[model samples]
Target: MKNFILFLFLFFLTNSCFPAIEKPDDYFYAINKKVSAVVDEPEEVKKIYTRELQKYKKYRTKKYLISSKYVELSLRKKDKHILVYELLKLNDDKYDYVSIACNYNLALQFEFSSPELALQFLNKAIQLDERSGEKYFLPHLYHQKGRWYYNKKNYKKALFYFNECLKNLNRKETLYVASMHNNFGLCFDKMNNTKLAIEKTRKAINILENKPSKTKEERLFLYFIKGNLGGYFFKLKDYSSAEKLLSQELNFYITENYSSEMINPSKQLFELYTITNDKEHLKKLIDFLKEGESRLKTTDRIEINKIFQKYYAGINNLENLKIYSARLSQLNDENTSKTTQELSETSDRLNNFIIKNINQQYAYQKRKNILLTSVIFLAIITFAFFILNIKTRNKRKHDSLERQKMILENNKKMLEKDIKLQNEKIKSLYHSLNLKIETEKAFLNSLKNIKKQNNFQTEEVLKDLLLKVNNLIQVDKRNYDLISECTLQNEYFVNRLSEKVPNLTNLELKLCMYFRLNLSSKKISSFENTTPNTIRVYKTKIKTKIGLDRETSLDTYLKTI
Candidate 1:
């Protein structure tokens, strides 16, 4: 008994003296990375929580870190109540990382349920992250906020946030930058600047292509961008490019069993084939659509039926056209009947409430009159007042409901009419422009002019074509101007940098100048016609040549020089 007591005391003393060591920053970072890597593996994530996170429960900073990770995992699993509970438990002022993570995670959670709530959380996250000054997740937060604005159809605000995201991202975050460009494309697409939309989307593709993907998610993201680009191409009537891109995306979706995603490419193909009078492609698309009919929403089904009606009518297939017309009418009636039934139910409820109120008032009035016959005048005055109040209240309620119903109907009609007008306008513009054929014609005319003027002088022809190409691609002049401006502004800085790092190459010197101007590797890569990864390598080499330690920031160092 004495030995046992002595051992317990010693154990307690040892534990009290040592306690559990707080995890270093590197350990925390590694564990965070590990959790992210195994997030898709439920068993692995469970093991991580049990073996690693559970041990740190008593430490405040580490505890919050674990809680943040749990919240993130809960979000992925869509465990809403648990996520909310965890978020509520977190002390936002206790740790900046935890606070930012909580707000960001909660914002994502609220995005589908309440966009306003999502915006509030997102703004808080941004504010806190910015104030913290580390900016580890600032760009991602910006992108999420941009996505929120995009979903709300505030394309201008979405673009602003997306541009901010792009401005803050570095070359190392290639995938994120690519996503922001894709968002830019989406915003431009919504704003009806299809040309600019196509430009941004192509740039996104180029960036993704230059950076090899290491995961299925990244590849899928690339395909998603391609699909959007294909739609943009279709809008611009570049049917060949559109056909190729859409076809690839359709095959990918079918193979991946992404039935919902399959509808978009299928619909675009159906329209394309009908417009081009390609019966072959139309029949194939029809087969695909019929096979996946159960996967489509009612709106999608109605749209597909309309497309079929147009196609069959165009081909003079009267029987098929009649069949599709019947289907379309039935679908429309079904959709309309749902709304009508809802309105009828609402009206019935209001009538029932009014009747109930009247019956209650009648019962009370009868009791009052029976009990107060001796004071009949007073009773009459009280009953009149009661009846007048009820009537006035019911009248106000009835008027309010009627006004709301009328307003809703008016808004619905206006929205439908506006959509119809917009669709008509787009179709007219597409038919009138015929951009592809017109552009080809213009180029051919230029070639003919060159042939006639130069009389087949090969050198002159080449020179003229070169001049036209240069005129078309005028971005180089802007780049040169920027470089010149940067050089002039940082002349003393450049001299200091050159004196400090005398062996720097021309490319390295240029990179230093760009760094001084705070240009990201992505932007510098564009100017240099090289990959961002290569620019990053040059940056590291510059840091080494300038004798900056690993802990020192190259950007800050260059600024000081």
Candidate 2:
């Protein structure tokens, strides 16, 4: 009898172990049939059909949780038929508690999507979830409702919901609370309450830093907050502080290597450099801007131009100002057109998401009965499978981590190599410049010596030529006579003038003597022994050789020499 009982127990266990498996084709056909039936119905009926189809498809695909998200959208669409269908389907399922949970979620999605329907869905979801003892969904529900109100520009309602989300959030779910804080800060910033915005954003950053799961999105948000804070300081003209914060944010974006996040910091740097009149900073900023412009779409050109305009105006440089102004005008026109196009695209996406959500919700409602009956059975199998999967996943993750470490090591080596090369190139250029400068200095010294030798020869040649001229005109006789007399005389002057101007010769010497006496050219030419014509010719020759004007008195030139 004990052996018979054991056999019976084994049989029961084996039977329970095998889960009911539906074919993918059968599941899809049923969903398609339901969707077709809804096509000819009224808007409310059609929405119900779409939701049911999505729920069924989701459940059959083992994506019930994701599908139920559509039901919330249907609620947002305000189709009573779809909501009633969801509720009816929800009530019929005891095992498919997830479907019921999804009903509340769909209600939240509905309220989140439309402010006019928000309060109704918010109360309904709270009541339903409270009755079901599923309080975990309330925080997100409240947060979503608040976001809807926020979108409608109802700051008070939005703050209340956000506060509720925060109150309900636990340490394990702190990231959600941090996200809400960031949203709150953004709302405050939009309202122009910078102090409140700053406080809230700081709170978010503090929380995120303390959290174990710090995501890239959270870090990016922090950077944005830093940028905004920098902007606030910049508006107050506290340039030094503004620059520090903006630079920190810019560096953060660079470290992350996110091109999109780099744009605002780059623009801020451009403005800061302009205000400070720092040419080196401006050059860096311009290079960054040009790089961004090359990568980003044309739609971003207007923002680029706006930055350029401010940069130009801050410097008050005429050439840049004109170029930026023209660019601004062109980009403004282009941006207006692009804005219209983007608006249309956004509207289309909103419509598609709405339709998809409604369909998913309805299908989830339809699959409630089957999923409810099988959930516990599936849960047991899923738990066992998950345990085995976790071990395999962990091993794979370990390998992946090792590979990533190796890549990072290689990257470090490349960076070090680049730095070494740059240092070597700079040293080489410095040495080359020094060598070139030394060579130029030696060459200039040689040219200087040549110029000095030429000047000396020129002077001696001029002196000898004057002596020859004196001999040709017999002025040496006057000089010899003067030397023999030993008289402190006009005789020395007479001899000197004879040597300087000797063609006439005596008459010319008299003329030159008169000139040496500080007489004008006209007065000198009137002296005895000299014809005016001969005196004029002597003066012309001296003027030509010495590069002096004939009109200048010889006494002046002689005194200078």
Candidate 3:
């Protein structure tokens, strides 16, 4: 907090983020990135937190740092993943002030995603303090609760919580104190107690302006007071004060790239400009107002339109007045609709209150009936349980015997089923082995006949086609990767061949694979992408490696393996 009262008043001083956001997305972006990192990569989360915190070590809010921001990001994204939940649970287990601070942060986060969860976290934080018998950041927790209620438009409850914050909070923590003061001012402003509101807002302005803000959050809070205080001045019809404060605030918001709060000051300034007949300011205001139609609230739209209407009326511009008048009528109808909506809301609130009271009474009566019925029911169940227990004791030995016999019978049946399954498995394996033997024989015989017919090209193609056998046999040679294709087709054969005949060349392997596939030397030449002489030389080198016996053929050796 820097002393802005003297500065704002003395200079009539100025100064104002998200594109349309009430808050700057950039204001939250860094926090979101860090928080997301914390959730997704907790082990690395420490280094990031440490680096950011170290930068602020000499700063006033070094201890607080941005630890709560992780939860804020998760809450904004409505991340329901167990990672963040577990992180919260882990922190909540500790009863220290830091942990309580963490809990309060989580409470703020959960207020958006899960209010009940937020309540639970707050209660736990409260419990931590209550058990410790000392206040530590509980004021901050209370202040946040005030904000939570304030957002929901429960000004009275919000005031109650803000009062709790002021009563319990330390005066030395100017950041929090200033925030509470600002919030208190806002609550009073909402209540329309102009004198009290003005007093509170001025107090807030002093605290914020005097103390240099320690954190981004503090700076943002200070910015908020600028607009809010401007709004209060506008309410008092102090146009000079409102214009000075609000204009500065708007410039600050623009510089900072923050949003929603800008709407408040922007509306106030436009009204001020129109009332003061400041054409230059009014024209400048139009640049923003056109783009801001969606950003301004209904109440704000109505107020702004009234200013425009007044401006048109003052100039006696008939066409412009007609346009403003028509828009004003439409806006007023909207207000009427909004007023009807508020009435419906009030009726709903009253009905809900009545229903809640009735439910409280009904719940008490039901609970009483249930307690009495439960005692009687328990007595009956106990009596029945006693009888059953005694009967069970007498039958215990006989039941044990029966159970053992039944177990033995089950064991016998299971044994027979196992035996049957084993026999079937053995038969299937035998059949498969026989079928494989016959298939190989037939394949070899067909190739031998092709060899007799000297149809080497046809035999080579047939061998290539046969490479598409079931995986249990061989892989299809579509890739023709000579190094691994043969090895993959029959690992045992490749391994044994390599073991017996070490250092066989790739060309030799290519020749051997064709031999294994029952292709003639001419077919092997064609498959190897080489001349027949090259195939002959490769086969000779392979034969020399294995020291192939003149009595046994290469195909027979490979097949045997």
Candidate of highest lDDT: 1
lDDT score for residue 97 of model 2? 32
Q: What tens digits encode model 1's per-residue C-alpha lDDT throughout 1-561?
A: 122222322222111111133433234344556666665577776777666545555553445455545535532545764665464454436656556666776776677788898889889889997996666468777877777888889999999988998898776656667877888998999999999999999998898888755455456667777888999999989999998998988898778776656667777888888778788888888877777776777877887787777776677676676677667766666676542444334333433343344436776466545534534554466568778988999999999999999999999899769545643443343333344345456667878887677456788667766765564345344345444544455576667777887678777877886675456788678667899999999988888767677898887776556
Q: Which residue pairs in candidate 1 collide?
A: none
Candidate 2, poorest ten consecutive residues by summed lDDT = 10-19
Give the per-residue lDDT of model 3 (tens digit) for 409-490.
9998997695456434434443454455566667677667776885468757586448524532632232234334334545
| TM-score of every candidate relative to the true structure | 0.49, 0.39, 0.40
Off by over 4 Å in 3: 1-81, 88-106, 112-117, 133-136, 151-157, 212-220, 256-261, 275-277, 288-561
Candidate 2 on 1-561: residue-level lDDT in tens? 122222322222112111124442233234334433453345754565466667656564333423333333333545653654555454444323343344444454454355466466556656664564544355666666676667788888888888887776554555566667876876787687867877887787788677676666556656666776677667667888789888888788767776555667677778777778889988777767766665665555667767776765565555675566566555555555542444334333433343344336676455544544455455566567778888999999999999999999999899769545643443443344445455556556655765777455666655655554544345334334433443333456566645664433554444444454454555444434456666667767665544456577555775332
* Number of clashes recorded per candidate: 0, 15, 22
List per-prediction Cα lDDT, in the order shown. 0.68, 0.57, 0.61
TM-score of 2: 0.39
Question: If the candidates were sorted by their lDDT against the true structure, best first, what order would they fall in?
Answer: 1, 3, 2
Ranking of models by TM-score: 1, 3, 2
